[model samples]
Structures are given as structure tokens and as C-alpha cells.
Target: MSLNSTPQSVRVHIGLFGKRNAGKSSVVNAITNQEASIVSNIAGTTTDPVLRPIEILPIGPCVLIDTAGLDDIGELGKLRINKSLDVLDKTDIALLIVDSTIGIEKEDLSLIKKFNDKKIPHILILNKIDKVSDKDILLSKSKKLVKCPIICISALNRIGIAELKQCIIDNIKEENTDFRLVSDFIDENDFIVLVIPIDKAAPKGRLILPQQQVIRDILDTGAMAIITKETTLKETLANLNSKPTLIITDSQAFEQVSKDTPIDIPLTSFSILFARQKGDLSELVKGAYSINNLKDGDKILIAEGCTHHRQKDDIGTYKIPKWLKERTKKDLIFEFTSGITFTEDVAKYSLIIHCGACMMNRAAMVSRIEKAKELNVPIVNYGILIAYLKGVLDRSLEPIKAKELLSVD
Candidate 1:
């Protein structure tokens, strides 16, 4: 993680998926102009998905993911196939590599269908074109098979590589642009206070990624960022010449911070801010209402984006469940998942509560939300759930332009 480099989560995630010995790894190495993955003649050389972050002319900072072959065999091969499919959840764009000599196979068609189902923009790459004699016939057959931008290239000889890169850039540009994090909330010279709690869960001697990113965004907007712990929030406010424009706190300290902060000043939590940045704010806010509908034996899923060393009073595993039990007075069943593992069987749970996805990209978060929507299961995040439990959900969301999302009593 370099200070000058962009984070992998924020970069455009480009996944390369195809069958065994389709030259997927070779294509990745060609595009990056580096040996990003193992290039072996043996089948299933890439057992796991490999992520390489690089900067190109049109795409800027992008993460290139080379995944295992789709046509792998046996039990271990099935596991590899599953892993390759999982990469689709975070892929903003895809490259389906086909060995020109072998032409398009059934497995390749299946990959195209998945790309269409996920609505992920993809390019069908005809790799090792030099090995094929009748290029025109192969091109014609491929066009009829999959209706996507198809490019012919020789990964070993570097033929058509430049055009392939430009095609990728064009598709990514057409997909979507970057969204604002906090610039929309503050104007130039406005003062924004961030109430960060210094507890055991807090990383030693430094702020977390969300806090750092918020401060950077505030500075980028020419606004002032006043950072203080929840313990010193009152004194910090007292010493200020005038009221701060807004106050943002950690979700764990929402109850105390909401009490100390004035009613007129807008207040929110870091998780809420991030929900708007990386996920759907309104949808998550609406999901908070599910808390009231929880039955005695209902099941809840607590999902975290990153896996960190847990402290005894960890907020996700301990505090949130305890708070929900007390607030709803239900003997709820809790299931937990951390890192990139998200269950596809979303209907089993009555509700899904996710952590602020600071470690995940927007594509990944949106994929999770879409899965929940398809299963008709309500999903909320840590901040909104905490605010709802604390009976200050509306007030905490006042700082954002999503007031219409709050439920009317």
C-alpha cells in the first residue's frame, strides 16, 4: 500500500476468465507488460485468482485479475471453477480469452452467459491468433457465437495488444465514472468535525482507512477537518469559535456522540457516509426497518468486509448482536462471515447486516446488495442499524440528502 498509489478497492477490477490453456495468463502478462501470472504449458497452472494493480494510458489505475480455467477437471477443478466464478462478484469488466486454435468451447459460451447475466461489460479476446491459419473464418464464427467486442491478438508475439488495451479502456469509460465520497456534503472553508473513538478496536497510533479518506476528501474540498476522540468531543466543540458544519462519528460511539452534539448541527456516522460512497445509502436505510420485524427465532447474518484481529469487545461480533438482542428483546440466531466469502443463499436469513465496506470496491458491494434484493431479503449496514437501535437514526441521517429514505412512523 503506497501513499502515492491508488488502493486496489478503488481501482477498476478487470477479470480475465476462460478455459484451461486458453492463454488467459499470457493475455494478462501482455496487457500489463509484466509476468503478472505463471505462464506454464501445463493445464490449470493458475489455481487461484491473481490480482495485479497497474496504470495504463486510458484506464489509469486498474486491477487485473487472472483466474483459473473454467474447463478444469475433477473435484479440485470444481473448486477452482467456483473460485473463478466468485471473481465475477467484484469484476467491473471482464476479458474472456479463447485459444484461437481451439476456437470457442461450451465453457466459453457459459462464461459469456454469466457476463450477460451479471451485466458486466466484457471483451472476447481471441488469443494465440498467430497459431490459427484461417483468421477470417475464426473471427466470423466467434462474432456469431457471442455478441461482444471481439479482438484478435497473439499474447506471445504482442500482435493487436495495443488495440486490445484501448478497447478495454473504452469499455471501462462507458461503464461508470468515480463517485464523490464527502465533497458533496461540505462547501469550501466549512468546518467538519470527526469524532473517532480511541478504544481497543482502534488500530494503534493511526486512523482507519475511512477516517483517513474522509480527512483527505475534506482537504480536497478546501474544507477544515477537526478530528477528536469521543471523550474530548464536548471540549472540542466548546473551544471552537462557531458551530461546526457537520459532525461525523464512529458507529460504536453513536449513542454518546448523539447525546453530546447539539440538535441543530447535522450529525452522521462514518459507516453511513461510506454506505453512500461504496454502496446504496437509501436501500440500506430502508433495510434498517427490518430490525423492528425480527421474530424470536429469526436468523441474522453479520458480514464484515475485512478480517482483522478481533479484540474482546469487538463491535461486529459482540456489541452489535448484544445491542440487537437488548433492543429487539429476541433470541435471535446470528451467523457471521468475514472477508470475501458471502453466502449466495441469502433467503435463509431474516436480515443481513453488513459492515461499512471500506475494504471492498463498489462493484463488490453492489453485487452483494443485488443478491439480497433478488432473494427478497432486507439488508442494512452497521451504522444505520446502530442508529436505529439507539433511536436516533433519523437525526444521524440528517446530514445527508437521503431523508426521504427514512421510514415514516
Candidate 2:
């Protein structure tokens, strides 16, 4: 990924959803002004969700997800429908395409209900308006059926395309604002220390996403970022004229970094910072307390945002589970999921341990957290859990001192 381009995890996610042959794909192509999705007269042409990253005039960078039709039939159709619904978890805004001639169907209504339940911003689109004789009457009927902003458009003929684009921009602006990764914590000329350990698990020649993003944020704030490994931390600190404003380390080195750094200096981890950036930080801290309540044979879910070959001492596959069992003194059952397979039945798990989610967008991470909350399951990320296990979780959170961190166990 280029430094100039926006990451997928930070982009606004817009999902297109409707029944089979409602022109969902057509609408996507029309709005993007590109053949982003395959359009066909046959039903269920889109088997899975197709994502297109583009730059809009007002919205900046956004991801347009074209999902499978909700009204698909048979066993395969059921699977496709489930996939379409799964897209809802990552959608910041949704577009419900309704065939003007046929009006809204039961499936479309059910989809709208889902958007309401998820609290997702949405626009009801009456497509194929060219085929209808009375477009105003059709749009008025749509407004009466669904309590959302309704727009009439002919996707094929490009009618009302500009208006729909503006609607998307307006709704997105209403729903979101800019947030910083680490710039808010420091000011111009402030010195920040970042401890990054290069072990076998670390990538060969590149810094991880979180570290790169943090450094970029610091530079953007006109602050000086000093990078060092855990072994050289003391030497690096001694060379600085004044004590650093903050110290950020990889979660694996929290114990040593906490000991080497002075008591007055604030300390934290990349994952902790990302927890605040990508998801609910307080919720994850509360979930960390669940570790102390685990029993032997309790099922724990270990989820990673990206997949890679597991080394002998892999953090997720080996290190975390081993350390967790040792800390709890229990024979815990562990299950794993990677990439886009997070939408599952989480009720069976005692707790969920997620990655820092540098590769995932904010909407996707929040959706998973929301799912855990709905199922009455506790969730924590890799850094928080590691800090808790190392007996330095509280110390690592000293910088933020959020209300939830104040009561952490």
C-alpha cells in the first residue's frame, strides 16, 4: 500500500443490497461510472460481495460493496443470501434498490428492517423508473412503505445519478467525522519513543501497519518519532535531551518496556492505540477482565484480521493460547478465524480475542464488537489480553486513563 492512498480499513464502506434482478449491480456501476460489478438479466448473478475502492467528489475515498441478491432460492441461494447479510456487518451506509414496476417485495422489507436494527444509514432507491409511467406516484408510495429518504433513478439510463451521489455524500458527512491515530496526544516538537521488536515473526524488511500509521500520524503533528528495539531502549532514551512525552511498544515487549521506561512517562502499545482508533476501547478493557474467570475446557475464540503462515512461535496460534492457559491454569478450548470469516455464531465462546485490526476498516471491527455485545460475549484484542497476562495491563493504559481503564481488574 502507498503512503499517499487511504487504507481500506479507514475508508467509508457503502453496501448495495436488494433482491435478485432489482438492478443493484446496475446502480453500483452507474454511481461509480465504471463496470464495478457484473450485470446480468439472470437472477443471482452476483454470488459473493464485490468491493470497489474509488474516490468520490464529496465523500473522498470509499468502498462500494455490491452484495448478492437477498431473494435467491435453493440451498446455494440460502448460502448466498447469508453472504449478503454478512456484508451488513461492515457497511457504514446501505442502498436498498427496489424495482419500480414490481414495487418493494417481502425480502426488500426484511432487508430494510435489518438496516434499522443495525442502526445503519440507508437510502431507499426506486430503480427502473423509466419503465414506470408515474414516477412521482411510485416514489411517494415508496416513502409511505419505508420510513427513509427515497430516491427515484433509472440506473441504465443514468437518470438522477448526480442526485444519488449527492445523497450519499450528505448522509456520509452526517454520520462521520475525522479522527486521529495518535496526533491528539502530542504537540509540535514533542519527542515520542516507539519500541518495535524485529523477531522471526516480524516481517523481513517492512514495518507493520500500526507502527507505520503511528509514525505517520506523529509526523503529521510535527512531532519527532524515535524508533528503537527493546534491547536498545535504554540507550536511545539516554541520548534524548529531555524525557520523551510517551513510549509505545509492541505488545510482546510490554513487560520489558514498562520496566525500562521511567514511572512518570506514559506507556502504551500499538494494539491499544488501535483499539481506540478502530473499535471500542472501553469494551475491550472490560472484556479483558473475563480472562480471570475462565474455567478448564471453556471455549475461546482467537480471531486475526489477516492470514499468514504460522511460525513455531506464532503469536495467535501458539504464544497467546499457551500464555492464556498458563495464566488461567485451565485447559481452554481454542478456535481460530482469519480475514473475512468473522461473522459466525459467537454465543458458544466464553471470550473473544481479536487482532489489532490494522488491515480492517473501522466499520468492520465495530461490527464484530457489536455482534459480541449482542450475544452477551466479552471481547478483547491481542494487546490488552497480553498486557493483562503480563500483569502490566494497567500500566500500559496509563497514558489514556479513560474512565473504563480506571476500574480495570
Each prediction's number of clashing residue pairs: 0, 1
> Please, what are the lDDT tens digits per residue for candidate 2 over residues 1-409?
4423777776788999998899999998998898878899999899988988877765667888998889899999999999889888888889999888999888888989999998889998989999999887877777788998888899999999989988888787333434467787788999999999999888999998899989999999999999999999999999999999999999999989989999998899999999988888889998999888899889999999888899989999899999998888999999999998984689999999999999887778988999998888999999999999888988888787832345444
> What is each predicted model's overall lDDT from 0 to 1?
0.88, 0.88
As a whole number from 0 to 100, the lDDT of residue 291 in candidate 1 is 85
Model 1: per-residue Cα lDDT at residue 171: 85
Give the alpha carbon lDDT tens digit for every residue of 1-409 in model 1.
Answer: 4523777777788999999899989998898898878899999999999988877655567888999999999999999999999999999899999999999999999889999999999999999999989999999999899999999999989899999988988887433346457777689999999999888778899999889888888899999999999999999999999999999999988999999999988999888888887867778987899788899999999999999998777888899999999989999999999999988779999999999998888889999999998888999999899999888888987777543444333
Residue pairs with backbone overlap in model 2: 9-361
TM-score of each: 0.94, 0.94
TM-score, predicted candidate 2 vs. hidden true structure: 0.94
Location of the lowest summed lDDT over 10 successive residues in candidate 1: 400-409
